[model samples]
Target: MDYSEAIAIADDVHWVGRYDPGRGLQCNAYLLHTQAGAVLIDPGSMGDFPVVFRKVLDLITPEDLRYVVVAHQDPDVVGSLPVIAEVAPEAEVVAHRETARLLEHIGLRIPIRAVPPEGGFLPLADRTLEFVATPFLHSPGAMATWDTATRSLFTGDLFGAVGAPWSLFAEGAFESQLTEWHEVYMASQQALVYSLDRLMQLDPERVCPQHGSVLVGDQVARANAHLRTLRCGIDRLVSA
Candidate 1:
């Protein structure tokens, strides 16, 4: 794959992540373009910020950026943000309140529009992104964003994987790939299931995780079914 351009996975959501053949894991950043402005999701670490920034610039101007959303305060998810703050200094950050508290410590001067820990939605002039708190899935402040317009769930790390020869879209084996990553990274099965239940209720048409290939069509339902019952973290360790 060329891996030189951003792929539009939805109507206006573009995948702006960098791929590394030297590493097993990778991070993903997304640009949500709207008539009002653009919203960046999980902008990845500082290492990948250069490419990510170039990609964003390819689509929209810095001044047009309205929100910089960090699903969790993990460095990989929020690290590039400090630099991003310098560019789009006026853009408000959207994160869970718990995540917001920790993000502030990073010395980012931009304002944070925190969603309540219980979960809520951020309304934009052209779109509304719903947030779901999936605590302990990856971090205590872990969360997911839902785009109802395209029915694509911007899950922080819920369906992330380390698949070989990574593709922008996942295939039938996506579940097993995701399972390996989740088994070690996710928390107890209860927390995983709780978040999965709420996600299923929304009936997402696609799954766009922060670190893996995008799941579309049936992959959404299939992956959800597999994860809803699969055990991980302490549950898997104990059952073993």
Candidate 2:
């Protein structure tokens, strides 16, 4: 398989993100095949889109796209949106209202289906996608997408691991890397705790973050538990 290859991560979900060895960033994106249509989660940065989009085309064409789900307004997550919008003009942009506002602030005028603060649902032909509000874990309007059919959670930044050399699916404990990433990227320990608590309630079978390997089985629970005690912001700085 080439660099622009799609790897199956779940039933019908493919990991279409590209790995930047030079930058040690996974910059993950996902192609979900839903009954209604195909959904691209976190299309990734403009620089990474060419490879990501090529991999996506290996599974489905641009016309097959139905929605472009935005976890947050981060460029790494949705920066290549102009290209995506041009190719898949019919794909409705799904994101939190605040995210929509942020995108608009940047002059992105594509159609948006904003999720409420409490979060909302996206009805696919065969399944309903649950959007859960996870505010300030990293971004103010951060939201995670839960695929009930596959029991996978698409967390924007929560549970992400930095550096490279990780597989598409984690084989062992990634606690150390996970901790390192969160301690610096996560806004505050309080925000992390609240978001982690809410995310854990879902008990996801797969934990897919925007920047790291997919955590599966018991690893998901362990990461959540480990994250609960993590300190960020002033606490981490003071301790250091």
Candidate 3:
């Protein structure tokens, strides 16, 4: 498949990936194209992302790719680091401090910058990216990025479902997706509630997750409700 064609949703500030079938163990990667250039977030594993990377390269030259953001260091997320480095050597790899160490241990040569847990912001020409650290949800240095320009959250592995639609939206029913995500992938009820509450404070208008699809319209409201329900459950448990 033409990786360049993988460009899923294009707004005024960014272009994202729509979940593709038979691409990887998950839906592959998300490419954010901005005036500051392109940022490839969680460029799936080598077995999955290489072809997509090549297509991305074909669409935009190295000079156009400003940064390759690896939200977490899981093989599913950072597995295609070497390929991204080769194509866009000028692009710096951004991750949390612990994730950088793990990447180094794995022998990847990409330059990594540690983002603070409280969240640190990176200023790009047209938009600003902020990294929020959320450890142990799935990985050690796991984090999420918020784009101020678009009010979009690039959440890695958070709020993801296994059998999401190709359009990157909930499609027929969101309840099923939410239930499946919580039941299978989410680490713990408490942790999930905390992460959702943290994210709710960000007030993002759009949610682009690593797996499954992107949630656009009414995303913030929907996400907040999900978090609220979980929080209520936790509160009840604590009281009990």
Return whichever of 1 and 3 wins on lDDT.
1
Clashes of 2: 1
Error of 1 at 163 (Å): 3.7
Residue pairs with colliding backbones in model 1 are: none
Prediction 2 global C-alpha lDDT: 0.86
For candidate 2, lDDT tens digit of each residue in 154-196?
Answer: 9988888887566778766678888888888888888988887
Per-residue lDDT of model 1, residues 37-93, tens digit only? 899999999998999999999999899998988889888898898899999977989
- For model 2, the superposed segments whose C-alpha errors exceed 4 Å read 1-3, 237-240
TM-scores for all candidates: the values are 0.96, 0.95, 0.83
Model 3: residues with Cα > 4 Å off, grouped in runs: 1-4, 12-25, 164-166, 227-240
On TM-score, the candidate that comes out on top is 1
What are the C-alpha RMSDs, in order, of all predicted structures? 1.6, 1.8, 4.1
**Clash tally for model 1:** 0
For model 3, residues 1-240, the per-residue Cα lDDT tens digits are 333465555464333343346543255466677777788777777776656666576567877877878778887787777877776778888888878878877665557777867678888888888898766556667888898877888888776656534445556556556555555555566776677778778888888777766787785567557643543222334442
Query: For model 3, where is the 10-residue window of minimal lDDT?
Result: 231-240
Clashing pairs in 2: 36-125
